[model samples]
Each structure stands twice: as C-alpha cells, then as structure tokens.
Target chain A: MAVDNASITEVVLGGTRGGPDVKTLREDKWWKLPLVTVLGLSAFVVYATWAAVWGDSNFFYLPHNIISPFYSPCLAHACKAAGDTGSPVFDWWRLSPALIILVFPLGFRMTCYYYRKAYYRSFWRAPVACAVQDARPGYTGETRAPLIIQNIHRYFFYAGLVFNVLLTIDAVQGFIWPTLHHQLVHGQYVTQSGGFGMSVGSLVLCVNATLLWIYSLSCHACRHLCGGQIRSFSKHPIRHKLWKFVTPLNARHMTFAWCSLFFVAFTDLYVRLVASGTITDFKIF
Target chain B: MADVTMRIWRGDDKGGQLVDYRIEGNEGEVVLDVIHRLQATQAPDLACRWNCKAGKCGSCSAEINGMPRLMCMTRMDQLPAGPVTVTPMRTFPIIKDLVTDVSFNFEMAKRVPAFNPPPAPEGGYRMAQVDVERGQEFRKCIECFLCQNVCHVIRDHEDNKAHYAGPRFFIRYAELEMHPLDTNDRRELVRERMGLGLCNITKCCTEVCPEHIKITDNAIIPLKERAVDAHYDPVAWLGRKITGRKKRSADEAAALRP
Candidate 1:
C-alpha cells in the first residue's frame, strides 16, 4: 500500500502552536457533570473527615453491636470500654479508631480507576470536559511524587479485600442480637440464645457491603486480575468464564463506583446517628 | 433514488461552518462515496482526505454524525434517515473540511524507542508462535489514529498532548516490549516520557477502535503492570537495589539466557 503522506499537509499557519486556539462554543450541559462531581466528592470528603475525627458514636447499638463501616476493625484501646465490639490491633495508640483502617478504603477510592478520572477532571481541571482547554498549561501525568503512589492500586485492592472481609463479618454480626444471658467463649464474651432478625442498620451495612463488593469486583484491576495476563481464553475455561461474568460489571464500573461511595458514607452516618441516639434502629424482622 | 442532505464542515484555520449540500445517494454506498460524489459533481473545491476508499488505508478518519468512524467503512444505509453531519476529528487541529492535523501522532511515534533485538542465532532469530500472536493484535493498527482522537487524555485535554502518548503508541510499545526476540526496557520511558500513567482505562479508545483491538485490556493495562513491577513493587525494587544490576541491554540478556 502506498503511504499517503500528501493528505497530512504541514501548512504552518501560526498562532498559538501547542493547544487549541479557539475556545469551544459548546452550549451543551457539559459544566453540569464536573460540577456534580465536585459537589459530590467534596460532600463525601467533608462528611468523612468529620466522621473520622469525631470518633465518639461511630460504633452503634450495643445490643445489636452494629459497627460503622467507617470504623470497622476499629484498632484502638478506647473502643472496647465504650461498650462496642472492635478488634484493636494495638492498645497503645490513643487516637481516632478510623485513623487506623480508613487509609485502606481511602487509598482504594483515591487510586480507583473511575475516581481517578472523576477527580482528575473535576478537581485538577485536567481538561474539565471533552474538547475543552485545561486550566493547566502542561501535563506531567502520574509520574510525580504523590501521584506515583497510584501505581500501588493493586496493593490497595488487596487491602480493600481484607477490609471487605472484616466489614462482611461486621454485617453478619449485626444480625445476632445479645440476649439477657451471656457466656465466655474463646476468652471473649459470647451472646447466647440470639434470634434471627434485621434492623435498618443491618440492612444498610449489608447494602453497603454489597455495593462495595460490586464496585471492587468491577474494578479495572479486578478485571485485569480475572483475565488480563492470559493470552488464550480458549485454553483457560475457568478464567474465561470469570472474565465473562465480570465483563458486564466492568461495563458499568462507574455506576458501581459512585453508588458504593455514597452508600459507604451513608452507612457510616446511619450508624453514627443510631449511636448518638438521634435515630432509632427499626427492626425489619 | 433519494437525496441525502450531507452537512459537511468547510473552512480553514480562521473559521469554519457546516455547509449543507443535497447529494444523491446510491443503493449501497458508503459515506466516503457520497463525499467523493459531492467532490466530483457539485462542489469541486470541497476538501476531504481519503485513500484506498477501503477501510485499510486509515486516511479517511472523520466523525460522522457525532461519532468517530472511518468514512470508507460507514455505510449510508446504516445511518438513520436524516442529514448526516461530517466533520474533522475533534482531537487535532483542523486544517480544512474533514481534515485535521494528525502530526501529533507522528511526533509521539518519533519519541518511542526503536526496537533493538539481540544478535540473531546461528541461523536467524526464531520467535515462538505464541510470542508472535501476542503482538499481532496491535500490529493491525493502520495508523488511522482514531484511537488517539477518541482518547480522553489528549482528546479532552489539549495540554495532555504534550505529555500523554495516547493509545496508538502504547500498543506500539507493547508490541516491541512483549516480542520474545526483542529486548528493550521501555517501561521507564512509557512511565515518564509517554505518560502511561495518564490513562485511567476508560476503554473509550478500545470502544472506538475499528480493528477491535483490546487496547485497554491488552496494551495499556499490561504496560501499567510492567511499570508497577519495575518501579513500585517493593520486593522487585529491593531485589534490583541489592543486586546492583541495571537494565540489561538486548544482547546482554540474550547472551545470559543461553
């Protein structure tokens, strides 16, 4: 085939050389998207910070013992005496319990494939929308100091899986209510004669866990883990099946990401409200 | 039998407008065919770039009805019954009607390190079928640059053009890096120079690829993994540090392998 370099005319009609000279004359609803992203992300961050700092009342309903998603696996000495169930890694640290475990979930979201694009456009204004000029004059990508840590997303993913397991256990614990009678089992206080029932908190935690699972499982890293390195899908039937299952979720990864983020904060807020005696945990059963 | 209202963009760098033209459509004609007909009959000076009128040439890339598609491949019958809007790609600087300056892609191509293979064996360099198959998908790229045009890194952010290499060269890097016989550590170059970290794997580039190349899943993600392994993986970084071994040249690694 004859290479057609003729069409690519190098007519150097000079003005501004690097970027688009003419500003986009688009009258569409382009600004709404980035604005929504900024508002949503900002709200979540502000609420999360407040919730994380104000450590009291994060763990709720001592009878049901439903731990907030924010402070799950609450690793601090202070949590035990507050009549809340939490596995503290060290008793020495005298700080907000959320300080210990929030990093994993935060890192997971910060380095998330969807969230990266969201914040990069919304917060960084890296070409706020398609065909729009960015606020920055140049781009260095994620090669720099702090952004380079994004390459550790896979590791954060592993940490996220561990947190998911802990949160799932917490959700399951939300179901078992402590009776009038109690016993000691395996050097821990055990609740006996508990019945199967559900509360709004339990349902909220379940929904939060489910949504997070969907979001994490649908992650681009998760998809890559499922089927990326494999050269031949035909040879690996099991991986192929897994990939097929994940394909649909991967298609809607953005939806899952946003929904899970909101639900997580909601889950934490709900527990905080219940702990503070602001809202009653309505029983579903 | 029917006349299709073809709205084509016509103007230079100063300004442009979508000028409507009534062009007669044949029974089984593509969008490029209609443009060619318009060029021949009504508007002789209507500037459009195309070659090989078949899909292989990659020269006739333009957005038809707000979607990036090859002019030769997009059949008129497939479109809805209305005026078809044809315009230059949004990513690059438009030179004229339906023709954007695609030199950005060429400039990125130059920055990629040339493939350096080790000295051939006693007879010649022999590559396994599996190794060859790995790069086959990427090699299908005809340099249409539809991937670059649709890529949000550069397409959305014009400034990103300075840093990001877009999807096209990432595939090129993948082909060279994954080739069994070839040896070159372009991971650092991909990380720093080509701006591999910018791709958030929206899969928009993959979606728009005419050749159906899994650009995100195959090329970009794997390149990311390689970069992470080289630079970020703590154990690997420690191992590299302890051994005091720099990146081996193609010949050095090949000589040590046997």
Candidate 2:
C-alpha cells in the first residue's frame, strides 16, 4: 500500500546520522578500514614506483640468471649490460623496460573486480563502507567516462597471462647459472652454459613466477573464460575440467593478489641486491 | 542488564523521524527483544514487523547502528555506549517505522527465469556431491534482502531499480546459470535487460549479506564473466561456431520444447 501523503520531513536519525544532511550514522571506527587500505595500497604504489623507475639497473643477476619480474622479457638495449639477452627490436627504445611492460599487469590489477572495490572504497570513498556517505554525492561508478574503460579487464587478463608465461620462463632460466667456461673463438671470448643449478635468487624468482601464475589463473576473467559461458558443462568437458581446477583458486584470488604483488617486489629486490653485490646469491645446488 | 536508549525511525513513505525509547534491556537481549519490550511497556502504537525472531524468517530487517542487519541477530551488549540508532532500510520506501516496501525485491524475484534442467534420465537425475556443492553454497541465502538493501546500484539510484535486478536476484540468476543440470542461458538476459553492467563490482552487497554468500565473487562476477563469454569474447564465439553448438536462451529453448 502506498502512503502518498506522508510528507518527507527532516529529523535527527541518530548517532552519526545527525540529520538528512549528516554524512553517516555509523558510530564505530569506520575510518580505520579505509585508512588502512589507503596506507597499504599507497605503500605498494610507492614501492612499485621506486623499483620500476629508480632501481631499473639492478634488476638482473648474471651469475644466477635471476631477472626481476618488473623488468622481465628484458627487451631493452640496456639489458645486455646486465648480461641478459636483449631483443634487437627493442634496441631503439631507450627507457626502462619495466615502464613498457608494467602497464599491462598494472591495468589488470587496477580493473580487477577485487581491486576496484579496494580502491573505490579506500581511495574514492564511494560510500567507504555500508550505509556510509559517498565522497561524491552523485555516483556514476564505471558507468561513464574514464572508469568505463574497465570493460577492457578481459584484454588485460589476456595480456597478464602472456606476462605469466614470460615470468615462468624467467623462473626456469633462474635455475640455469653461468658457467666459468671461457673459450677463445677467433678473437672473441664466449662463456658456456652452467647447465642445471640453483641459487637463493633462483628460489625467489621461482616463487615469484608461481605466485604470478596463481594470481593470473585465479583471475575473475580467467575463471570466466573457463566455464562461465558454457550453457552445459556436460558438452564442454575440457572447459568444465579447467573450471573445476580454477574455482577454488578464484575463491582465493584476493590472497593470491596480495601475495603475488608483494612477492613480485621481493623478487625484484632479491635480484637487485645480488646484481648490485649488496647481498650474495648463495648457490643452493 | 542496563537501561538502553533506542533511536528508531518512525514514519511513512513521505517522511519520518527517529523517535527515541528508553527501555530496560538485558545483557543477552537482542534489538528485536528491546523493541518488543518498548512495544509492551513504553510505546504501545510503535509500528514494526517481526516474525521468527531467530534470524531465520528474514523479517525484522532494519538498519541497526546504520548497518543493515537483522534486528533479531544484533545483541544489546554488542552495541557501544549511547543511543543505538535503528532506522528503516534506506533502499526501499518506508511503509512505517521499521517496515519497508520490500515488494521491489518480490517483483525482481518474479522476473528471474526458473531453473530449466534437461529432462531427468529414466528414474531420476543423479549427480556427484562435488557438482552439487556449488549450488548448495548459494542455497544458504535466506531471502533476507540485506544484499539488495546494501547494493549501491538500486539503493542509491532509484531510477536504476527499473533495469537493475540488484544482488539478491543476481545470485538467483547465478544459481540457475551455474546449476549443472540446468540449460537456460541467462547471459544476455542479465547483461542487457537486467542492467548487470551497471554494477561496478564494488561488493557492498557481499559486505551486508547475512548468509556470507560471496554474492559479488561467486555470483555477480561469474555472471559478468559469462556475459563476457557470450557477448565479448571472439574466441568463445568462434569455438562455439566450430563446435557447431548453439546455446539457446530460455525463450528460444522454451519455444522449441513441447
């Protein structure tokens, strides 16, 4: 039944809700969560920025073949300085390769279903928490303008999978250390492969790649790609199988997201320390 | 046991006010218990709806302490000192004090396509326990509509209510879509007709869900991915064509059936 005549009257709601003009009626420490989120995410951003831009040179360890995930697929001309193979195609590019490669994975995380919530609540304060007032009175969300670009998350997911593959290759290469074999062919000297070996740097890179793979596979888009559209699982057996495998992973996407994020930076730091001779890359073989 | 002051909203669709009531509240008493005591001793004409005070009925839903929660479940002692503000769910039009016109949710529920499983095999359709577990997780929903109340798509935007099915029904769609035996395709329905894209996946719905259903992750996000699979992904489209398999919508499948 419609109560058409009940006049909309302004009154003191209670607690935090002083009135209609009041932002929220929440009495608890509501700001704590958003504040923590801001600090955590901001620290990650700051660290990521430092690693990507300022510490670009120390991202590769030649003896252990440990490559930082941030500078992976080391396609720059400068990669040769670190004893990593450099692609001739990217020889013309002068800047840090991390800048070129980071955009893809960055986009993936920024538009992620979980990250969107984290940043939206913490950064934008778009109704920071339940029943809380929005920072902006009018909420357009991802419905318009720049935020609407989030529809490209699947594209970023695809891009992220490529990065995962590249990182996994880096991890595998981490197991192959440089040999002491020096040969004189004509007038030049060449070093031979150390074959299969391992180091502390190798384990760090391995864990980094593993976490990235888990994060990529556990992605909401990847999970969708598996069995999301299948009308009947009985028909698409392979997809159904893949879907089953990723379902549990997708549930822990948030954990993997944070773990992989931190581990990526740690992998970089480990590589940098070894490359700069700040720390020793102890052989584990 | 202590004296508690409750600032409960009182009024109708037009407007309302937070009317305070001081009542003798026990330590073990719930918000609903206090409201009942107030009704018995203090305010005889206080308007509020309640049933099955054990949190199962899904009634007695209100915004206690500015959080959408079941009044039956919120204990008196859990709340901090001073007045506990109890208000009608902000999402829907208030009918009276704590009651809202949750008929919006009912209308949305009616629009959800029914589960259309393929005809049962002989005696009965048997399934593995692992296959049923996913649906079981979604089945824990008690129709509290707290998810709906907290969802920003409809809660904030009144106009969006026409197109958006909100989180409650999104889970309903997800349940039917993910059902192993079910054949109905709701990808286009949810994406186009039900305004699924309007949901930015902020996950306010998940936060308020009393049943702890992963409404955003398990339900809405999966539905979005399914919609992407059908509408956006060229690879899936080509694969479907090469396989010569066309998944029909509910209408198309229904039209073909006897």
Candidate 3:
C-alpha cells in the first residue's frame, strides 16, 4: 500500500510523506494575521514593560484621587515616593509597586485560554496559522512540564478576582477627592474630605475596573466554576443562573481580553500625563 | 472560460504523484466543477468522492493548495494564479486518488458514549433558549474533518490516534456535556480515555471550521476548564468533600470505560 500521506507529512512534520520541499503551498496572504498578532501583542508588552519599570513615579493622580490600574493595590513603600499612601505592611519592600501587583493579573492574562492561542500562534509559531507548518517540529503541547503548569489558571483566576476587588476599591476611591480648603483650627492644617465627585480620570478608572471585572468574569475558568462539574443545571439553580449570566460574556472573552488590555495601558498613560502636568484633570461636574 | 491547469495527486495505496491536467474552467466555477470537467474529458479513472456538490454534505473534503477546504466550496477564481494543487487529506491513509480512508473518525465516534439524558419531567425536557443555543453552535458542524486533519496531535503523530478523539468528537463531547438534561458523568471519560489533556488548544480546529464554529473558545476551552474543575480545583474538591457530593469514584469511572 503506497499511502500518499506525504503531502501533509512534508508540510507539517518536514517528513517525506511525498511532496516537494516547500514552506507552504498556500500562496495567499496567510502570514498577515500572524504578523498583525505579533505587532499588536508586542506593542502592548513593550508599552506595559515601559510603564512598569521606566515610567515617572507619577502613577497616582492625587488631585483626582485616580490611581492607575497598573499601580492599584499599590503595596510597596516606593509607592509613597509616587505620592500614593500604601500599606505599612509592605513598607519594607523597596521597588516598583506595579511590579509586585502585576504578577497576578499578568499570570491571569498569560494563562488565559484566548491568550494561549494568541501567543502560541504569534510567538511560538506553532502552526502559525491553520495548515501552515510550524517554525519548529517537536510538539508536546500543554500536557508536559512547564506547559502543564497552565492547569493552575483557575488559581490565577481567583487571584485575579482579588485584584479586581482591589481595583474596584481604587475606582470608588477615585470619587472621593481631598477638598482644597485648609483649616488651622486645631493647630494643624486639614483638608476636608470632598464627599462625592466625578472627573475624566475617575471615569477612566471606573471603565478600567468595569472592563477588568468583565474580562475576569468572562473567563472560561469562571464559567466553569459557575456550572461545569454539575451533571444537572436544573438541580443547581443558583449556579445555573450565574452560568447563564456569564455564558454570553464568555463568548466575547476575546474581545474583552483585547479591549481591557488596551484600556488598562491607556488608563495608566492618562494618569501619567495628568500627574506629570502634561494634561489637566478635566472635572465633569 | 479559460484553460486552467490543476496539479492533482494521482495514486492508490502503492504510491502516486501530482499530475497536471489542463481543462476549461469558468470564472464563476468552483474547484469541484473543474475536477468534474477533468474527470469527464481527460481521465475517467480519476477517483474523487463527492455528493450533493454542495458545501453542506462535507463529502468533498480535500487539501486544495495546502489548505483543507471543501472542493464544492472553493471557487476557481478565488485561487491564486498558476497550477492548483489538490491532495488527499493527510491525516488518514489514502485509498485512491483524492479519497482517503476515514474509518478512523468513525471508530473514534463509536467510542464516544451516547447522550445519557436524565428521565424527562412530567411536562417533558424544558430548556432555556440560551442553554439550547450553546449546544446549537456545536451542532452546526458538518463533520468535514478539516479540524481533524489540521489538528497536530493526530496529524503529526499518528500514534496519538488511539487515545485522542480529535476536535470533532471534543465538540460532540462538549455538546453532550453541556446538554441541560444529560446525566452522564463524562469528566473522567474526557480526561482519561478521550485524550482531552493532549490538546494544547492552538485553535487550528477553530480556524479550519467551514461552519465558522468557535470550536476552541466555545467548546474545547470550556471542556478543559470542566476537566480542571473535576480533577485540579482545590476549592471544588473541598466543597465536594464537605457536601458529600463526591465525583464519580475511580471504580465507577473504570466500569464505564470501553
């Protein structure tokens, strides 16, 4: 039997299933998608790396009480240098607060089901596009060491939920500004707490928080947690309801993943610009 | 109409090679139409499998220009200029010409446990539109096996075929798993026997889906997450222990195995 499995074996495995040596017989612009994926992901990674390490320590806009999503739950003592009051528990650690806080959210995004597809195709070039030969041949996938660690994605999802809560707190705090009026009544100057207000920065923070919440909630792990293990949805009404609410969001997880990623970076840039006096914090009220 | 050269694979189990055939193909014609013209005029012995000549039948699946597409669906004009190369699906052993033995898929299909729904209520099985719609997306699959052909697990390594059910059956499992009324506990089945763990989810299956199903996002990832919940989740394990709503025991799971 002279089975002609040669064409695919040649393309996929670089084997002599019986075809000519060719990168791909596909003549279309198949590379365009992988190229765009590389550019887009690389841009975000570069911007995020810059914002994390090299940004002017102005991640917190004091006037508007808006903290960058990158710097939210800012726990490091170095945050005080950035004019943001962080917990004394972490006062010992001296480095970028963004670095400490980013690991959880970064882990969440890195192990994300959608992101796995993006990076595997764009970065690893594992069959870069459908029917396209992979850059390298040996394939073990997530079943083995290193890649098997991706099974901890749900734990990261838990950590992401905690971060989402902290960021939501930061967004709520964005609404409470320090009143400009200073009082000397008690032999000490005091700025009254401005009760409730809104600003462009606050709105930005709110949107960032909302998007992050949606992204986290729309996670496949989240959807699974809600209703996956159960044999019957009718038996678990509460979990079923939660699953129902999340199912639609889960469908658009990819959209939220990109939109939230871009907005988080944009929110940081907005805070940086305002804190650096490059742009004024526009008050909507 | 213009004369177009098609470099198609011509061989049986023994061996074959790409043989070119110049035939008159119309601008509006599809690749299948071109093949039909070639079969009628040039070579009557040319073996090709097709039914309905429509994309819906999924019978005319082959690798056209290194991409798995239905011959009925690929328009001649859409192909790039020069000789078009058509080959049999590489995942399966070739029977003759463009036809390959797809019995592996059928064998895998038979291994899947039938949908085991719970006894219907007095009013019958009622499901929300959203719940039904979730499974509906998976049902759109025409079983063209493009996803199976493109999947790296079985494509690159034929040895994985025994354990791995490929993407087509994964969606089948997902559809059954997500069925609101299904009572079959398939968590162990998916992980152990069906080879869900082997899937790295590169999404080649999702990309090649002719029906545009979100195979990776809607089906595979969710199934992976479900498997995670079953075996890996610490919190879920704790809850199951406390509530005494234990997962299927190892003995129970083994009994259900083929």
DockQ of each: 0.14, 0.23, 0.27
Candidate 1 lDDT, B98-174, residue by residue in tens: 88888888867756666777777798876556456668999999889988876767765566677677899999888
Rank the models by TM-score, top first: 3, 2, 1
lDDT per residue for candidate 3 within A1-285, as digits (tens), equals 122222211112222243323556677888898898889889999999898877738788666688888877878776777767556357787777778888999999999988988888888887687777767767767777888778899999999999999989999999998664674321334465576888999999999999999999999889888875454576688988898899899989989999999999999999988877788888887
Best by DockQ: 3
Q: Write the per-residue lDDT of candidate 1 for residues A3-86, one digit (tens) a residue.
A: 234443332322222212344433346679899999999999999898888755546566566888887786887577556666
lDDT of 3 by residue, B11-93 (tens): 87677888999888887999999899899999899889999887888899898998888999999988888999998887788
Docking class of 2: acceptable
Clashing pairs in model 2? Answer: A6-B14, A17-A25
- Higher-ranked by DockQ: 2 or 3: 3
Q: State each model's CA lDDT, in order.
A: 0.76, 0.78, 0.80
Instruction: Find the candidate with the highest lDDT and give its number.
Output: 3
Q: How big is the positional error of residue A150 in model 3, measured in Å on the Cα after superposition?
A: 1.6
